[model samples]
Target: MALGGNPIFNGKSFRGATQAPRVPSYPQSQPGYGQPQYGQQQYGQPQYGEPAWSTQQMSSDQLQQMYKMYNRPSAGPAETGRMTFDDVIVKTAACLAVLLIGAAISLFVAPGTSSLLMVVGALGGFVLAMVNTFKKQPSPALILGYAGLEGLFLGGLTRFLDALYPGVGLQAVIGTLAVFGVTLALFKSGKVRATPKAMRFFMIAMLGYLVFAVINMVMVWTGVVNSPFGLGTSVHIFGIPLGVFIGLLAIGLAAFSLVMDFTSIEQGVLQGAPERYSWTAAFGLTVTLVWLYVEIIRLLAILRGDD
Candidate 1:
C-alpha cells in the first residue's frame, strides 16, 4: 500500500480485501447464427446450427431489467469490503470513546490506588502496543484494551500533575487538540507531507528521543537524579530547564507522526485495504495521540514547576 513511516502500517498489506465486482454482460442474439431466416423457416423442421428456442427478441420486462441493472450504481468501498475514510473515522471515534470512559473511571479513584493503576496501565499498554504492532491482522478487543489502559495512565498522570499545577490538564488537552487540528489541516491542504527525506529524519530523531527517554528513566529509577523529572529539570540551558526543549521536540515528533498516520490511511483507502484494517489505522492514531498528550502535559507541568 506504500504506507508511510508509521510502524503499525509499514508492513501491512490488506491481503484478503477484494475489489468491486464487475457488471454482468448479457449475450446479444445474432441474426443468422441462432435463428432461421424470415422466409427459410419450415414448419416442424429445425434450422442448421440453430437452437430449438429462438432468442430473436427480448421481452419488454427483460429489456427493462437490463436497463435498470446497467443504470444501477456500482458498489462502494464499504459494500465491496474495502476500507474507507468513514470506517477509519468511526473506528477511531469508538476507540477514543472507550479511552475516555477508562480515563473517567481512573480519575474518580483514590489517589494512591490511582497511582498503582496508572503504573499497571503503563506497563500493560506498552505490552499491548507491541502485540498490536506486530500482529498480522487487527483485533478490535486488543486495540480497545490498549486504548483503555492508556486512558488510565493518562488520567492518573493528569490528576497528579494538575493537583500541583491547577488547570494544566485542561491546557494540555487544548494544546493537543490545537496541534492535531493544525497538522491535519496542513496535511489535507498539501502544505505538509511525510516525504522520504522527512521520514528518514523522523526516524533518526525518534531514535535519539528514545535513547534520551531510556536514560532519563534509568536515572530516575536509580536515584541518580533527585528531581521529579530526573535530568529534565535538573539540567538547564540558558536558565531554561532542558525538559522544555525536549518536550517541544517530542511534541513535534508526535505531530509529524500524525502526518505519517494520515499518509498511511490515505494510501490504504486508495489501495482498497480490507475494512478490518481500519482498526489498525485507529490504533495507530490512538497511540500517536496518547504520546502527544503525554508530552504536552509533561511539558506544561515542567513549565509550571519552573514558575
Candidate 2:
C-alpha cells in the first residue's frame, strides 16, 4: 500500500476490485472432430457417430447490434460504482458543511452552555475519531457525527479565544485555508510528496509532539504551570514563546499530512476503491484540517498574548 503515513488507509485493499470480469472464449473445434467426413451428414446435422451442432445465421440488424455492443466503451468509475475524485470532493464538502452548521449552532448559544458543549464535543469527538479510525469500513453517519462534534469544540474554543484576541479566529481560518490550498497545489504539481523517508520522520515527530501535548495537559491539570498554554506560553526562546516554534513545526507537519492524504486519495481513485471509501478519504482530510486550524489559532493566540 502507498498509504503508509495515514492510518485511515493503512489496511484497506483496492486491488482488482473494479476490474471487469474476463470474457470466456469457447474452445475451437479440432479438425477431425467437427469436420464433415466423406460419408457424414451436412453441417448442423447429426451424423451416425457425432452429436448434432446447430448454427444460427444472424440477420443484418442483429449483426449491427452485436457490432455496436462490441464497440461500445467500457464502464467508467462512476458507472462501475468505484471511487473517484468527484466522490471525494462531494463527500468532503458534505462533511465540512455539517461541521460548519454545528459550529454556527455552538457560536450562537450562551457562553456557559457553549462551554459545556465544548467539553462534550471534545470528549465525543475523541471517541468517534478512535472508533472511525479502527473501523474496517467507513460509516457516513459516524463520520459526519465526528465532524459535528469537532465543530462544537472548535466553535467554543474560537469564541473564547476571539473574545480575548479579536479577529484571531478569522486569521486562523485564513491561515488554515492558505496552508491547505498550498499543500494541495504542491501535491498536484508533483513538487511535494509523502515519501517513505519523510513519512518515517513524520511518525517520529508526531509521536514526540503527542508526548509533549500529553505532558503539557498533565501539567496544566496539576497546576504545575500557571500559564494558560502551559509550557507553550510560559517558556520563551530569546523573547519568542516556545509555542511559536512548536506551532510552526506542527503546521508544517499538518501540511505534509495533507500531502499524504492527497496521495492516498489519488491512489484510491486510480485503484478503483469502492465509492463508500470516499467517505473515509473525506474523514481523513477533515481530521487533518481540524488539527491545522487548531494549531493556527493556538499559535495566533500565543503570539497575540506576548504583545
Report each candidate's C-alpha RMSD, comma-separated, in the order given: 5.7, 4.9
| Candidate 2 lDDT tens digits, 96-195 | 9999988887899999999988899899999999999889899999999999999999999999999999999999999999999999899889999998
At residue 34, give the lDDT of candidate 2: 59
Q: Could you tell me which residue pairs clash in candidate 1?
A: none
Highest-lDDT candidate? 1
What TM-score would each prediction reach against the true structure? 0.87, 0.87
Clashes of each: 0, 0
**Candidate 2 clashing pairs?**
none
Candidate 2: 10-residue stretch with minimal lDDT: 49-58
